[model samples]
Target: MEVRAQLASVFHLDKCLGCHTCSVVCKNLWTDRKGSEHMWWNNVETRPGTGYPPLWEDQQRHHGGWVLAGGELRLRLGSRPHVLDQLFQPPTLPTLDDQYEPWTYRYGDLLGADPTKDLPTARPVSAITGRPIDPSAGPNWDDDLGGSAVHAAADPNLAALDPDERQALLAFDRLVFFHLPRTCNHCLNPACAAACPSGAIYKRGEDGIVVLAKERCRGWRMCVPACPYKKTFHSWLEGKSEKCIGCYPRLESGDAPACFHACTGRIRYQGVLLYDADAAARAARAPDERLVDAFRDALLDPADPDVAAEAARAGLGEAVLAAARRSPVDRFVRDWELALPLHPEFRTLPMVFYVPPLSPVRAVRSDGARPVSDDLLADPAALRIPIRYLASLFAAGNERVVVDALQALAAVRAHRRARTAGDVTAADAARLLLEAGLDEATADAIHRLTVFPTLRERVVHPPLAREGEADRDPGIQGLVGLRRRVTS
Candidate 1:
């Protein structure tokens, strides 16, 4: 049991309001610079639509993540020798069009144009070239199911569904969609770190936050394709690669990441997770269908004595262990089993998990009139968003696990509604909870954490002990801390 402490997160998709506050705040803080315009370190994409880089989930084209071969995991891009050979020009690298040409409108045209001219207006122009251009795409081009026929129809996850199911889902009357906020998973087995030829990307030993050192980066841009999530990007002007740092500078000072702080929906939860390193390795190598279970098995109980002893041996401080014990992420993912990893088949061992959204109940039309199903609130099996679709996204095509999670979430809702609304009877709620393999106390606990987590409860991390390290160098210390504050 090679226990190690890692920072992890859970996003409750049901609560996400799709307000884009998290994305805007993250942009202003991190990627708002020349050559970084195309980089959205945090982006919210709509489901049933191609993501930012347009078809990024189509690993067949991007050649990202990892692949299992002969019971061993290897980079989908290729082996080290193959990667080195293509160092100069990566054949699978996504073009600027694929990522959308960053654009801006010429506001000066509107200001300076003749007053008599026919309704002076700003003209769209490329942010990169400063030339007139017709804007067609953007980071969230398919937001709210925009151009659904074209963009939403091309969703890669829909490949798992039968043709009949696909057609029914895309039908005019049954269209369904949800917001998917994304960031670097800060994976336990980081493909970006593994594919970096210059060794610029590395996970921090203390907290497991992946950092791409600008000084060490050679600008090979291998990390771009290697990152299955497409979170890594190249800085054309600076000749460096940049990615979400998980706001480490703030974290070391005991604050949450900017996105988490700015989130409008309060859907984000961050905390410490204790996992067995060896178990994580084995889990990553498990067959596709078993990946979710294997991944969950890899996470150790923070309160377990044996796990604590191993974590101590691995140099985890008491503070970190305590945080792990109180982690809301652990409760959602491990204790209640309501949250699951996104695309576990990618084999990145992502630390970020999601509580999949519960869609509207499927209804039927009778004699030109529609009636909601009687089991609208009871049967999650009547999910409007096909279980297979969500399974592809989170459970590596394992419908059973996805069904289990959705059922548990339904039980929580049922239990709460019974208590508050008086519409559902106590016996009915108990029966539903029992069917979902949950007791009343456990259901209430899950409900409380999901619906009413405090700021400290949502984001939990121990002191990083960076002050002593930062004190070693006054120049760096002055930048990272308040050492140079003018306090006469």
Candidate 2:
């Protein structure tokens, strides 16, 4: 049966409060277990700063995401199903020494002692690696992707100047900030689904939600790297790859995802969207403007009768169709034209939409003005929009996308400054943090941890043959050992 298509999304700039309430709610409901402490199915982060686990965006350094090969966007996971399945399996447990090592802070050791005239600052070192642990790195490092404070920290133009001078320069120049909360985009053409060897991952017919059948999963980790967003994760305990299921259980019952339900911003909206199934498949196989642009254009009118009819013919329920008719996303997507896809170039055809942030440019001036009324820096959320973060989502290999996106947001802020014709003082709090040299250090840390090794090694090597002797290969050793152990 043809599956119906539905969509949902969060407005990072408007609704999230970074309170961790959503994360806590989800943790207690789903991931609060022995192996889940490090896992946050729903995590909130401080933008313009490193996110949890740090620098997850430096996909180039980490060796993740898509690559353009022979003019096609090739998912890092091989095109074949078998190859992807083989990679999806869970990993074997490392020895305790490898998994859990003791940790301590060196500076903590000097707290109460009679110290030298100049007391040294605290530094952290890893007990296991015996190397100094840089404090500022992780998966979500650059959470705001260096849009605000991090940007100011990285740019020498802003770094060398004093606070007042920097504020004057910013006011003179005009700047802005925004926030982008992200999750699995659940693309119309999902690389994760295509890469599945067992055909276990499939998009639902009812709502276009993607799902993975645990029993059919062989624990290959191909999907982990295949997805540019890094949304798919391998469950070592379950020995399978898993990802966002679009909260199907709740969706079926007319509710929203755990993250959406718990979102304080109320920026999330859920509804059905109709796209030509044939077109979707074509886009999945061969993405281009003709196909992808058509789908995006349809999002502009998700509630059109023709669209609803098409969705119904695709096996969507009347209730779902009715919901789509009134969905706020439909209005935002079509009428207001405020929503845009997170990353269009990934060729995954993601469905989430974001309302561009508009706060930063209103804060500062380029002409050494006094203060302006339109500065976004006055608002924290406005400070969260970093081009780096968006570029991380869209431009997998290039850093320019992030720079461009940031500049675009900054332009918007600049426009606000021009409109308001006001002078403003830049917040020293964000500026001081930027000057302390923390952002880049943190981004570097996140990039290191998110690395997924793709080195190729033979699991079963051929036996070497001595001169004139028939040789047996070592391929059967594992089987033989298993048999012997079982029989004995």
TM-score of each: 0.94, 0.59
Q: lDDT (CA) for every model shown?
A: 0.85, 0.47
Q: lDDT per residue, candidate 1, 255-275, as tens digits?
A: 899999988889999998888
lDDT of 1: 0.85
As a TM-score, model 2 comes out at: 0.59
> Candidate 1 regions off by >4 Å?
365-374, 467-488
Q: Give one digit per residue, the lDDT tens place, for model 2 in 231-323.
A: 666654566666767665665444557777776655556554545555544444443324334444445244566665654454345555555
Query: How many backbone overlaps does candidate 2 show?
Result: 66
lDDT of 2: 0.47
